[model samples]
Target: MYTETPAVVMRQIKTVNGRRMIVLFSRKYGKISAGTSISESGKNKSALALRPYTYGRYELSKVKDNFYINGAEVLRSYYRIGEDVDKYLQASYVLEFTDKLLPEGEPAEALFDLLTEFLSMMEERKQAYGTLVLGYLCQAIAWSGSAPDLGVCSGCKDAEVKYFSVKDGGLLCEDCAGKAVQDRRLIFPVTVDIIDVFNYLLESPLKSLHALALREDLEKKVRNILRSYIAYHLGIEELKSESLIV
Candidate 1:
């Protein structure tokens, strides 16, 4: 039996010894790794198709009970991502996060589409990459069932002006957050508002985000809360790409 699946090129690592692996985000099967090898020369067609962030059509074939990429064709090279240092790092972070968050072979059409849209947004959009990334993160997390609950204060349920609890998922009204809790970071009103902005921007037309204005102070606070939330859910101390911030 054989299966044909649609996939996004998450990344690729090439070794001098001819060991090559392509990390792929597939629509039907989720994240996967496929081995590919060609002549040592860089002119190999298979090598070209599996480069990082290159969306393409591929044929996965079974060899010794393992799935390997036997052939492929480049659909979009995503050329601009590698042209600049900031762009390259951001793109890498997105791909790395996707690989870590999504499980393999789970059939996620929504995720597949979002990832494809992300790369396109990165390569073509000229606006603030930070805003674009944050907006997508909020939406993507929501889609994955880990969305921070911002509808009501986690503590008081007041649904009014409040402080956010990263350890508790989202905002907490004064009454709810009055009790002492360790590592409970304060979320200022501006931070809450910027979070709303990112949420709103995610739903806004793609054309609008190109000119989106993300206030530095507010954006920073919003991102801090988001990072804390992600760490709480994933139980990670830190993100590797966070250091890549310039």
Candidate 2:
């Protein structure tokens, strides 16, 4: 059986047998793995499509429950992301995070689009990479159905929010904030601007995020906020590629 799907190469791991196993996040089949003997010598048609950061249509053949990449055509490589160290590292983190969070064989169409948009934009982006990354992180979390509520206080619901509680999964009202202290929940005061920016990132499209502006210091803060939230919720201690941002 053969199938074709739109996919992005999330990763490529080399097997002991010298073949490459590509982990693809596909629009149709979600996350999947297929082995290919495609060499990177520019002689194989599937080689470029199999490289990480390449988005393309992948043709796969199924044999005894395993899939092999029969052929592929690269749509957008986003290869420029490798031109700069900062872009390369952050972009790598984006793919790493996506690979880590999404479950195999579960299709998330919105997430697939979001990732493609993110990679496309990242390729040409010089500034606002941090903001773009934060936006992607927020959208990815939301798409995964683990988004923290940003509207009402997650604790008291109706009260005005004063702080964000990672343990509670969202903002908390003053009353709830005091209670959280007693219960030893980790909480941090949130500025209105931070809330507004985060809300915008969560609701806006990836293209709009390219023009989004924030003071340099605030950008770092927001990055930490989303990173901490993801780490707490997803159990990811730290992204390996995060060091390049600083």
Candidate 3:
């Protein structure tokens, strides 16, 4: 069967006989791996669409259980993302992170649209790349249904929360924090600023990220907290592109 869909080229691996396997996060089919002979150097629409940081319409042929890319046309390409090393690494980290979050053949249209918006915004962003990354991470985690409880204490449901407990999966009250520490669970003391940053990122749209900027200290602190949170809940320890970012 043959079908066409809008997709982002996530990653590509070289296969035998010069053919390549392309991983795509498609709007219609979610994540799918398709084999194709199209070369990035070829002067054709399909070839251009095969490159990274591209959003394109792909024509795929499914044979029994496998998919092959027949043709494609670039809808939009954030090629400029590669111009700066910082921007490129950040963009790569998100793409890789998204690939890990998605299950094969499962359609996640919300995530698909979020990625599209992320790439569009990142392409034009000039500073505070970490802020954008943090926003994307918060939104992505929420969409994945594992968002940390920020409204109130995850334990005891107390309105007054002072710390974030990774094991409890959210904010913790002072008492809960003491108990968590006694239990040897990992927890971080959070300020109102930290909690507010997370709340804003989770509730606001990606486009609004431009309005928010965090001091380097605050951004790193939140990033570390989310990293540990994601590792515990999502089972993702570290992404290869993560080290490339900073």
Candidate 4:
């Protein structure tokens, strides 16, 4: 089958002979491998669309058993991400974490939109970049069905939670924490308001993210929980793009 469709670059590869890139978690095929040629390289590579985090339209076809990208047109390079160091790192974090968390060819349009929105947020202007990313992660995980059950205390039926458990799922009021942490625990309280904010970012307009306040400590807390949860589910120590950030 030959098709021209929108895609995002999840990974880029360079070998002594040939150049290739993997577009995982695509909205169309779920995952894809696109072959490239060196002739496309220069100051302005037509294949920049194959660079990680580059969102654009691609011309792809199945040749024998493998899928190859015969051509691509870059729609948004998210180039501003490279100028700011913090934005750059967080963008890398987003890519690395998402690349692992999403299953290949799983039909995730929400995931794709979520990723582009994050890049768009970074490109425009965001004072609380960390919080922005964390909130997006929270919603993405929830959308992917791995989100922690933050609705009620994981241990007790207390309506309000004073802490969170990464190993278990989410917030656990004092009573729940005591009984639930035999194996592992993360103690924290994420406000119902925070969850609401997460939902908005995931489902609402990407532009709305600019207005939210990012609590620094809570931002880190959310990231910690989401990253651990994703790592646990994927059973991988590192994502291919981890080096792009760390």
lDDT of model 2 at position 165? 82
Residue-wise lDDT of candidate 2 within 139-204, one digit each (tens)? 888887788888888866865887888878889888888877533435767889888888888888
Candidate 1 or 3, higher lDDT? Answer: 3
lDDT, residue 18, model 3 = 85
Q: Using lDDT, rank the candidates from best to worst.
A: 3, 2, 1, 4
Runs of candidate 2 with Cα error greater than 4 angstroms are 181-185
Query: Candidate 3's residue-wise lDDT over 115-229, tens digit each?
Result: 9999999998999989999999999999999988788898799999999888888888999888764345469899999999999999999999976678999999899898888
- Model 3: residues with Cα > 4 Å off, grouped in runs: 181-185
2 or 3, greater by TM-score = 3
Where in model 1 is the C-alpha error above 4 Å? 13-17, 63-65, 186-192, 201-208
**Prediction 2 global C-alpha lDDT:** 0.84
- lDDT by residue (tens digit), candidate 4, 1-246: 898778778777665466655654466876666666634355454556677778888877877767777777788889998889888887787777777766755667877887887788888865777767766766766777775665677676688776667677666787777677345534445666555554465465555667776676655555565566666655645655445543
TM-score of each: 0.87, 0.92, 0.96, 0.82
CA deviation > 4 Å runs, candidate 4: 38-40, 43-45, 184-206, 233-246
Candidate of highest lDDT: 3
